[model samples]
Target: MRWTAFLCRLAVGGIFVYACLDKIQHPQAFAVDIHNYRLVPWALLHPWAHYLPVLEATAGLALVLGVARRGAALVLGGLTVVFIVAIAMALLRGLDISCGCFDTDGGHGVGLDLLLRDLVLLLACLPPLLVRDSGPALEQLWRGRP
Candidate 1:
């Protein structure tokens, strides 16, 4: 069970880290992708696009490093839920938008495919959320004063 939690952290963390790299490098494209969603107001598009990647990267790094497992899991888990909602709504409304999971110039858009993928990732978050003592978290192993 603890091993499961560790695996969950790695899977989800790796995803967020992977997802943010492109967006962080290509803020303008990400801004356009956010605009395509038409959910956030225009004024917020640039800022949200710019800062979200930072948040995603930070929390993801924390999870992977096992420095703050519970807090990072909560944040990344909540983010997964948000992504699921956005993807589902985009599919339901038939809006043509980048899913924004990985890249801004997307081959992957919000649809049944991406929605299902996000749902599976969300499920992965559960073990870390529920299991307090995840196996061999690096922070625990370090035994250094945090």
Candidate 2:
């Protein structure tokens, strides 16, 4: 279970860091992708696009490094929840927008597929939060020394 949590952290954190870095490399295109979603108001879109990657990268790094691991996982789990909601809303509204998740090369877009994938990732993250204290090394859930 500890190993599972670690692997999950690695998978999710690496993807987040890579995705954020990819967007950081192409802010203009990412901003355009955000614009296409039409969820962010025009005034907020630019600022969000500019700053979101930094937060994502920071959180991702924190998760991957196991620095404040529980806190980082909680934050990222919350973010995944928000992302799921936003993606669901976009898909239901039939909005045509790039998913802008991992693949920033060009062919990214939001749809049922993206939502399902994010949902799976989100579910994958839940066990680390749910089944408390079984893992020997997790101080947050366990009662003993780390």
Candidate 3:
């Protein structure tokens, strides 16, 4: 169980960190991607693009480092839910746009596949959230636990 939680943390955290890299480097392009979704308001596009990546990176780091793993899982899980909703809305509305997931430029189009992927990522967040003790976490090391 401990190993499961640890592995789940690594998987979700690594994905989030990787996903944010392109966005962090290309905020303007990311803003355009978010605009393509049409879910965010015009006024909030820049801010969302700028800050969301940072948030993802922070949470991902915390999860990977085993510091505040549960909180990080919760945050990443919530973000996954939001992504799923955005993708579902895009499909239902018949909008053809890039997912803006891992990359802001030429990303794959929104589709059921992306939605399912996010669902799986959301599921991956569960163990860290539910498990009381994360295996070999930085938190334990910091507290001098063997």
Candidate 4:
């Protein structure tokens, strides 16, 4: 169970890290991607686009490093839910928009496939939250003896 939890942290954390890199590098394109989602109003779009990647990357780093693991799990889990809802809504409305998830500007289209992946990832986010200890954390080391 400990190894499992650790793997989950790595996988979930890795995903967020991978997802944010492109967005951070191409924020303008990410902004455009967010715009296509149409979830945010014009005024809020730029800020959301700019800040979201930072948030994702931070949470990812925390998870991967096992620092504040549970909190990071919770945050990433919330993000997964939001992504699921947004992708589902986009598909339902026939919006034909890109998911802008892992790739903000590589033209990754929103579809059932992406929705399924996120749904699975959301499930992945759960065990870490429910399990005690949540694997080895940097917090553990900090409290240990030299």
lDDT of 3 by residue, 1-146 (tens): 88888899999999999999999999999999999888898888899999999999999999999888889999999999999989999999999999999988787998998988998999999999999877778888677652
By TM-score, the best candidate is: 3
Per-residue alpha-carbon lDDT of candidate 1 for residues 20-91, written as tens digits (9 for 90 to 100): 999999998888887787788878888899889999999898888887888998899898888888777787
Q: List TM-scores for all candidates, in order.
A: 0.92, 0.82, 0.96, 0.93
Candidate 1: where is the Cα deviation over 4 Å? 141-146
Write out the backbone clash pairs for model 2. 99-109
Task: Please identify model 2 stretches exceeding 4 Å from their true place.
Answer: 130-145
Comparing 1 with 2 on lDDT, the higher-scoring candidate is 1
Q: Backbone clashes in each candidate structure, one number apiece?
A: 0, 1, 0, 0
In the range 1-146, model 2's lDDT, one tens digit per residue, is: 76787777777778778879788988888887777777789889989988888878987787776566666667778878878888888888988777887645666677787778888878766655554432433344454544
What's the best-to-worst order under TM-score? Answer: 3, 4, 1, 2
- Best-fitting candidate, scored by lDDT: 3
For residue 14, what is the lDDT in candidate 3?
99
Off by over 4 Å in 4: 144-146
Provide the overall lDDT of each model, using Cα atoms, as 2-decimal numbers. Answer: 0.84, 0.74, 0.92, 0.85
Clashes of 3: 0
Off by over 4 Å in 3: 144-146
Better of 1 and 2 by TM-score: 1
Q: Give, for candidate 3, the lowest lDDT window spanning 10 residues.
A: 137-146
Candidate 2, residue 8: Cα displacement in angstroms equals 0.9
